[model samples]
Target: MAGKETKKGRKTGLDEAAIRGLAEEAVFARGRAYRDEGAVSDVVRRGDTVTARVEGSETYRVTVRIDAGEVDDYACTCPYEWGGACKHVVATLLTLIEAPEEAQERPSLAVVIGSLDRDALARLLLRRAEIDPGLAGWIEAECAAAPGSDADPAPVAAQARAVLAGRYAERDYWDDYRPAGDPAELRDLVDKAVPRLEAGDGRGALGILEAVAEVFVEDWIETSGGYDDETLYPLFQDLGRMMAEAALMSDLDEDERASLADTMTDWDAALAEYGVEDSFALAVRALEIGWDPPALQAILNGEGGKDSGTWPPKGEADWTEGELTAVRLRVLDAAGRHDAYLHLARAAQAHAAAALMLVRLGRIEEAVAYARKAFGHPDDALALARALAEAGRAEESLAVAEAGLSFEPNESVSLRGAHSVVPLARWLREAATESGRADLALTAARAAFAGSLARADFEAARAVAGKTWTSVRRDLLKTLRAAERAPERTEILLDEGLVDEAVKDVGGAPGYAVPEAVLLRLMEAAQSSHSDWVIRVARSRADAIMDAGAAGDYAQAAEWLRRAALAHESAGLIDEWSATIEALIERHRRKYKLRPLLEALRF
Candidate 1:
């Protein structure tokens, strides 16, 4: 219960000792200072809810809802936002040793459908499909498969469908605040969107439906337990119908209309295998173009590609000697091979790249360790400082930053960390709020603002002021003081498709206006910079953006690359600018199915 009452659960096979051990281990291992105050303060049970308030320096509360001996939903007001699983959650789960007798006594799906024959199971599938078409194929598959001596396919298929539906239902709880892409929630959205489209609300339907046709290939990377292409034909057939209608009847702007057209094109091809000719035709015409599916598939499948030896060139190394060394060190550090990467990275003189990779691998301590060793390299030192800060070793991170300032008292140390402080503050704020220490969150927020201010530009840095971020902690506290009521904002700027505005807003924060913000305030600062600078900076940011996109950070990556492209243009580097812009256009096409640049210029 983050600002509300804690729910309790019926006590059954609850193990206080086990939960306590797990809780203590999680807190102590994580180096959390709060767990030392006390033990589990209160263990209350109410129906299916189990809530515990652990007393440390402050009260740390947790709510756990158990379903069939498994932890279903968990929430904590702590700074541990990644994956939404904190010590409190682990503690609560530890506390739940088993389900209550009543829970176990309840009739499971197996009990109801266990006795059903093949035909009976198929009939049940028909019933479930009436509610959700995704279940139809699953049921059919179960019916077709030969039954084992003890096997019951009907209940098995039904259980699979239930699990899928449940994932969709619980998606709202999975926050985007985590670092890894929320693939589970996205797939859940797809499951829900398919059903929602049946009601004919295209905009609302599309809102939930991200244009992830590229990801569709990735989704099939691993074989799943659900229906295959053969059995799932009807589902695709339905989807093709939806796409056809969406393309023809869509009132979206040119870019969005093109995107819908793109969907139509993809579904038209997809539906061809299902023999849905009518649906396929509508989808094909909606895009105002047509392509032979077999020909296109052949090319994409790599049959018409250039020579294997000439294209990509195997074993020559994808990067330069220096870049490869850097990548190796990063890999070593990430793999917890700290000693190896550290030694090799230094021997190879790739400290900067190694340090950056170490940070990416979450080896904060190891990164700092390498940085200390590579103090001879300024770039490596900077990367180490960033890694430390990113990993929440803030005090050490700050020390590195300050030391860099002492030797070469420049804007690099300060401005280098401007972007990283957002998440750190978020974590700090979360921890502080959970421990009844608003002052801590506020302190982190002020430090974040100060870091932003150090950027040598003001207006540009405040543009990324996310409401959940620690930089906005003061604003939250200030709102409380002024009695200014604002709805609690949970979603990120990009989540609402306002990433461009967010960049501007974060740069405009009172004490956060850094030099970069001011310098970039001009219309074409990106292109106006020196040619060498444009090439280097655009390529750097472009690479980072692309990495982020590959990891599903679409909105954030798109905005960063856009700025990079503009910079290239200002430097009179038309080819570089156009190439970067084209990449961004492709990203938009794949993500929202809209070409952002073409839409803006109408070219």
Candidate 2:
């Protein structure tokens, strides 16, 4: 846990809420079980990172990066899907929260490396290579001589292929960081090009990127169960992007650029064969046009143009390549080239960025005007609105927000994810309400409720409804009871003490279909008054697991069986509970591991 007071409002490194947020109900249960059983060991915290080995089916190496006392990123060498955080990560986090003393303090990797002299480092590297044979090829590639222009790229390509291939037997492709992107073996190799780019060795960077991209795409095999889309596939896209930036910084002649363009085209075709579409299109365009078209330059110089490819650029990606423009803008911004940053951002149609820059430049009118014209999405609008509100232009902020909403923009990205959280509308509602514009607030609140269907939004809408609450609540409840709204509605109903409605809705549905928490809460709440229903639901769930002879699921089955037993006792059917357990024990008699669990649930 990040046990420090910070400006970001984290009270500790981790809490139950934080850890539980990292996983699903069932996953947290398993992780808690693992933690209670001491499955996580050798826990170490280094800087903002925590690393531990979790004894799951196999020992999984887990690394969690904490920032501002929250999980910024995490990875585990386990083939877990569905749940965002795997069981190993959950177990490790549980260990951090509940058993902080188990984690040993360690020097950060940088500090450790800094303390090592060249001779020690060499010895350490040799030792590592001795332990992992795959590292030898990697070390060779890292120590390879940097070839200048006109040098062959084959050596790099061959070494990359050999290193990746040699690493496969040991790789096992266990890490499925998924949304965070997997740590491919090529990552270290890919990183070598970054410093070259930073040093303005564009051609050299290109050589490294091209060779590595070739080898990575063609030779690097993903052995994990998840799709490549969730792993190294995105890195391949990043290669295209990095190469584009490198090409931009390179001073290549027209022929060289054209040749590079063809090479990119060939790479794109190769990627297309692998189910990737237009992977190198941006890089090829970067080489072909070089971002210096006369029309684009006119706009960059703050000059008007009749054919500047849609002036004001809709503040979005133009035919010239938005992603490439973003790369250049980032470089300029990093170099303190403020004017150049604005030019590139505007020219590249990065409307949101351009507007934010205008706002920071004290040009509120321009920012509001520009943002309204090309509000990329709800987030863009929300950003400008907040800036405007912060700038004391509340009315302007409200106006811009309304205009942005007119585009039917998707929800603003938040912890609930982009699809579920209607942040823009929610913000507008709060802003409008604070400004005493109840009507506007009500409108925004309604929009938020419609999008989110969340209990908070529903309550917000009700609090603001005034005289119309009766009708509004009824309508909202009706909508929330729709087929697709089962999960959210069940939660709301349970919270509102509408147990009968919740029972009928949840009871008619399959036990597996309802949210586990909702299902369990229903069982807990109905244990006395609706004990028969609880018995049916819990027994059905436990029977499903036991009937399949699923050894790993016996614990979960035992949980349901206990719930069933409690319900049976509540309903004065304790004998029935014992009879059910005996029947299950006899029916699943061949499942030696599950019988003991069934016997334990006899009470």
Candidate 3:
């Protein structure tokens, strides 16, 4: 998940709110970090698709479909299993969003390919094939396989074998995690099945999944393809999910379903040997129960299916249930089984998805009612509240948002919490203030400050605190004092003009160099009121650098010395300041960088 790391870039041209809506709050925030840190590079825009490599644990290739200047579809070659855009995709999108200029414009693949003549194209293909040993055979196999044909796993199986043999032969090194070449090449083959999704060609997809999985598992067993580090986890996770979705979308007969389920069970057993268990549980469930569980159908038909305890022959509280329910919702919605989708989402506690669906269905009041009781996660309330606000239901939105303040999860309580706590609380405060609900606004303001210790948040809380700023400031200061972020703590106090507080706790330490800008401003602000503290802190800071022979920081030491001199002069200690400067020159005459800086500090 993400936390703030000094938003030092332009606001993204892409819809920040819409992007946030797409990802979990934590993931969105972490993407912000990746973008800020310049992790996204090799950015190239080819018409609607933006491609980049986001450098993290490993360099991941990411592509996002940009339609109407907004994200339409995205994929990342990273092992992130959590729902929503993975950090790599998020980072790439953010690069396109915030720093659009960094993305070089290029012609789309269609344009380039269309412009090429047959001979040129053949030459290009031959050139690439010569470089990549697997490309020649893979292309031959692909060309031989006809589209719209029955399931033919042989071509794909051969392609996998060719790609892997090349990868293994070309491997430069081996380790527990660093597998031969890249699993992403195999994942690229998995992505090949995605197009089959358009026709709901579950049969075609099955052929591809079966072929790829066979090669992947066999490679692990035969060689030291070491899947032990979960280097291959993302590929298998995506494979199983795709298989589940295919089964759900397929109109398989009872026998076909049973066979598919057995395939998943076998794969699960094989993977368990390498510390991966329940590898195909979701796929197995999808194949075994093709939406005809008597209990599930009964509930969907409104025939008393409220047995939450036995929804999945009794509910399972892990991530699998959520994933399974998600697939069910997708299939049911596609089939226009709106009523069934609603019932299943509620049973699975997928309140956020259900509430959003209800809002779309224009059952606004029902959506609000469901969300009021659906405090499953911040998103549960967030989805409905955002919907209501967009619909001009100001009062209802405030009510939902207020209830959400109490539902903050432990994971998101940190200032960097993905709880959407900061933004959600800010929205509530501003809207409540506009609606003349000052008390509500004030409470929301407090929540915002607690969630994000930004100076802006602090000022927003101060604005809404009315006559309670006295007590409110005390509580906020407590929060700041206890926070792990020392720089933020100092910035907030300094910004509030609490020089004494900033000086005592933040800058009092001998070697603790508060940011140079903050230290410089602190001396300027407290020269008259807290000159002694400034002199001690500033002199100590400059002395630390000079004493440590920090050649690169001599300029900063000189600046700190100048500020300390001003503070000393303000306290009528100019003579003392001169003595201190002269002694500093003699003590480190050997330090060439320090000599001139010290001599320049003298009157």
For residues 1-603, could you state the per-residue lDDT of candidate 3 as single tens digits? Answer: 222111333233475666776776447767877888899999987777778999998888988886765678887867576789987887777666666678777889999999999999999999999898778767755653335766577777788776666455533344333344565667777777776765667777777787777776676555544435455677778888888887888878999899878877887887888777776788887887677777777767756634632345553445565577688777778677898888777666667777888888989898888887766456556667888888888888889988987876533211112455777788888989998999999998988888887788888989988899999999999998887764567778888778788777554565254655566676798888888777887778788878888775676678788888898888899899989988889999999867987898898
What is the per-residue lDDT of model 2 for residues 1-603, given as tens digits with 9 covering 90 to 100?
345432332234677778878788768778887888889999988888889999987888999999987899898977687858988899888787676777777779999999999999999999898888657765556655243334245656766676555444443345432322245555666777787777677788888888888777666534322235445677778888888888888889999999889988887776676677776787888888785676666665667655564432444444435466677765565456677667667655566778878888899988887886766577778888988899899999999887666555443211111332278889998999999999898888887887788889999998888998888888788778874754577777887788888787776444676777678887888788888888788878877776776676788888887888888888888788778788888888888887787788766
Those runs of model 2 whose alpha carbons end farther than 4 Å from true positions after fitting are: 1-18, 67-69, 107-163, 170-185, 188-204, 221-229, 292-350, 372-377, 386-399, 410-421, 427-446, 455-479, 482-486
- Measured with C-alpha atoms, the lDDT of residue 84 in candidate 1 is 37
Q: Worst lDDT window (10 residues) for model 2?
A: 412-421
Query: Which regions of candidate 1 deviate over 4 angstroms?
Result: 1-134, 138-186, 189-356, 359-366, 369-445, 449-603
Model 1 lDDT tens row, 107-136: 335666788999999888777789996565
Error of 1 at 407 (Å): 15
User: What TM-score does each of the candidates earn?
Assistant: 0.23, 0.76, 0.61
lDDT of 1: 0.42
How many clashes in each structure? 39, 5, 2
Instruction: Please state the error at residue 287 of candidate 2 in Å.
Output: 2.0
Q: What residue pairs are clashing in model 3?
A: 2-30, 310-314
